[model samples]
Target chain A: MALPGIASFLVTIGTLACIWGLLALGLNVHYGYTGLLNFGHVAFFAAGAYASAVLTMPPPEQVSQANYVIGLDLPMPLGFPVSLAVAALAGGLLALLIGSTSVRLGSHYLAIATFALAGIFEDVLVNETWLTNGTFGMNSVPKPMRETLGAGGWQVAYLAFSALCLLGVYLLLDRLIDAPFGRLLRGVRESEDAARMLGKDTNLVKLKSFAIGGAIAGFAGGLYAHFLGSVVTEQFVAGVTFVVWAAILLGGVASSSGAIVGAFLLIAFQQSTRFILTIYGWIQSVLPEPLSGVLPAIFAPLPDHPSFVPSVRFIVIGCLFVLVIRYRPEGLFGDPNEVTVMGEEE
Target chain B: MASALSQFLQAVAFGLVEASVISVGAVGLTLSYGVTRFINFAYGEFLAYGAFLAFFLSGAGAGVVGLPVAAVVAVLLVGALGVAVSRVFFRPISDRGALPLLITSIGVAFILRYLLIAGASAEARQLPVPLMRPVEVAGVGLTPLELGVVAVSVVTMLAIHLLLQRTMLGKTMRATSGNRSLAEVAGIDTDAVIRKTWFISAAAGGLAGILYGVLFAPFRPTFGFGYLIVVFAATLLGGIGRPYGAMLGAVLIGLMISLGSTYLSASYDQAYAFIALVGVLLLRPEGIRGGEF
Candidate 1:
């Protein structure tokens, strides 16, 4: 049932873009809304996925063999809810711990601490073979309604589910941002000392923001895990964190729609590059050997190699970050007047 | 019991060797932070570039010219990179706030890493330098390579200390770090001091990278990325901008990692480092040796 033409590919990319957009929105709550620089948001995502997967596991032995622990053999409908809850719980708790310890530190210090903590979690995932099965990862996790509904139906159902989740999250965030609590958060984001002097408990506000942001990230992670049908440590690496950060930056940090917009643009750009390179390669095949070799590397090879793509992605994404920071720190959707604190503007 | 004791002693010695390399790198980080007032995410890339340069040079038969000469070349190359980066990236954002500078540094780091990947093969390359054979002391084995690293690091630190205390350039650097405006007003060439700081810091980082490559034998393009966090933890623990504090922090980190690996699973070694860092931040946010936050 292979769909022909670029339309199918475009649809596939659009779907992923939506997911990434949702993830980025979660990140916005931390970086854009509250002005917290979290470098370990991916950990929450991983935790969500793993928790969901483990919650749906059959037995101890089965989970062990699968290198995951989803403890129950329930249907995806039930499992999905549990996964989200588990992720939020875990993420919130971890955020609480992290916030309690380092939220009082400056923004930069908090960022580094989270970054280091992310690395430690990754290390744990890789080394704790008993828990995570080292690096081989878990597979064969059932998708929602895959057994009852056909592939197409499952896809449609999942897409709808994801949309609902995204909508719910966005609305909740919108309401939160409009409320007095959101004002307090924005207040702290603008000037922590001033907020403190105004009798606001800045630390408590930061901790709450961190916890909520982490919970949102965890919820997205659960969705991603279920979609992939398997979870790996690679998915939660610092690189993914950076990618989400990039998306938030591109969309407009404080703008809700910016998160979705940035994710769509980034994913579309990435996929389009692949398509363009493939076409270039086809054209190069017709040319003489000497000319073919001289063509840009993108046109010369299809880059079927996984490592090549990731390395190139890093370079490109890194450049994008630099460009955005230098020329468009406001991001595409961000308020021009809302300057980033922590030394960039002032 | 005796075997465990021996193992403990062996771990300490190995940890010391590891700490020496880390101290070298952390000092570079501390120095840059001390003067510039921003964490250079590209600091790890300096180490990476230096090691890669040495790997290429040694492969080109420069080792026959002697290890010291090859090391000097590597250091010089990395120092040049640091100077260039500071001039091109840091100078433009010198007056800008911290986050922008941090982001710019990240960009610099990203560019260096990917450029290395593009230029060199993605595969991990073994450095051409031969590891000195291991020698035993008190029923515990130690390698000449490790011993050499410790000696060189100590010498470098001592020289840096003296240069800071006695040399005009070092004094100027110190003065600038202490008060850039006052130093400028006092007829000090702050830019020259910054350049010198970048040169020494990057050279030290490069030397550390080379020593690590020599000891570990091989590394991938992203090898230094993993160590960046650990280095930051050390820097934080040692006091953000104090060189000696970095050394002490490195030692503490090294000991924790080595001992943790021995007692618990090796997988938790890095986690132990993170936990220790968190503890330090909670208990002593100013670090063991206080510095300007």
Candidate 2:
């Protein structure tokens, strides 16, 4: 990697980390603070991304070959806030809709239901081509202040913007976690019966927590859409949901800062796997013939195919998921007692 | 009008075939839930693996006896794999409530799926079943293979019913599912029952997968995973823990998907299944038959 290569790589990684960090942060609100098992979280993210993209993109008449149906073509100043607000509202409303019924059920049921919802969202994205341009995603998504910032500076600017959003959300969540509402959320997670005995409307509290968490996730989706400069259905899959789950689990459930660290570390791990072949080649060249031959032989079982690297990554991630749950269920930063998602026998 | 009626009948015929496949799969899933009290998310992978194994074996010169023998071998092997997986990965953490078990199942599912992708490659492969022309039955065209699939599924379901109702193992399973501690107190050997249940359930799942492949050829690594939600809808609709309910739910979902795809849009086939699941989950979480297995 040259200086520019490293810089651009860092910028891209930093940008993605911040977006994922936002998602993890929101998930922490749902899973960590409220103990809601929201398995289909990518739906909210997709909603936010699509909402932002559709709101900001040029009208159908403006683009010569417009595949999508909706485009408000709002200017950046008006578009950014409106789009984000829409995203947040969309996510919050969706959470409210899903959470109303499933929040009261066992976390496992909630997980299954949410997982289905995400699948439905993906199906819609793929099938309803008129809405999201089907499999061929919409292109040339407008960025905030892209005209003001030159092409070279846009990446840096976007990275900064995403980081700030992550920070802001973190601080906001911190305050919320300490507040009475947060206590109520925790109360519901700990023991709904006990909370109900104390005259707390636990269901309402849970629903609110779910909505807030969803809103945050939706907001991150808006930022992600602008970062990518295009919204594709492939980007929002069930795998993304698992990745966010891994982040929360790795970081430590119920810890805001832990979620950020987990998100960044996971993003870094995913990115680093792309260099597996390069790393292997470097090792082979640096070592003696015997050692190089032995190393290649040892790692020969591991895929050399670039296309298969993603599969290897997922296999590792899946292992991590099982290992984390089996050995360190509370995660690195979480107190075992504070974690109630995996509570008493159902 | 005649064409529309034929189209409707055709959908019904196709729906019945789809139902047969789903019934086996759903029953497999529900059986585990009944005994072990956790939905094995990797059950779909069991089905996929079963189909893949059969595909490999049948392709490797099994000839006339190849498909049936391969399916039997695959089912038993996958059943054993299921037992081993639960013994190693699930049984130790089984005490940690259903939520952790559920999450762990998801992990197992991911591992199994990706590993399949790595080993078999991501490309779709068709099972080596000769294509047969569709036979018209009262204006509805049904392939010979499709009728065979339905017949095999019905036989399997009947066998399972006998296993659950008449056999000592079935009695023990029912007792264990009803109340684990009580069954233990009654000296039923709940662990053995559970192990046996796992084998049966996983075997059924594998059988279902093989049938799916036979009817719907050219399946990828994700074939079973993609069909998982629809199976879920069926399981939930018939009632989660009841094998009979699963059969009912499978029939309903199969019809819904087939009819909806024909009438609405082919692309939204799975979406219709999801809608059925959501409706059941919301309107009647307990399912049609809400009680004991």
Full-model lDDT for every candidate: 0.78, 0.86
What level of docking quality does candidate 1 show? Answer: medium
lDDT of 1 by residue, A1-346 (tens): 3345664565567666767777788788888878887878887777667666666655557554554443566666776687678877777777777677778878778778888777777887777655565687766556766778665556666767777888788898999999999989889998998999999999899999988987777777777777778777777788778788788777877888888898888888777777655777698789988777666764455444445655676688778777787778888988866655534654
* True contact recovery of candidate 1: 0.52
Q: Candidates' TM-scores?
A: 0.93, 0.96
Query: Would you list the clashing residue pairs of candidate 1?
Result: A53-A70, A54-A69, A54-A70, A55-A70, A56-A70, A57-A70, A343-B97, A343-B98
Instruction: List, residue by residue over B1-293, the lDDT tens digit for candidate 1.
Output: 99989999988887888888888888888888878988788888888887888877765444554566777898999999899988877787677688877867777787778777866757787776565667997878887877888999899888888887899987888888889999999999898889889999888888888877877767877777777877887888998888778889999988888888888878686777788787777788678987542
Best by lDDT: 2
Chain B alone vs. reference chain B, TM-score for every model: 0.94, 0.97
DockQ of each: 0.57, 0.57
Model 1 backbone overlap count:
8
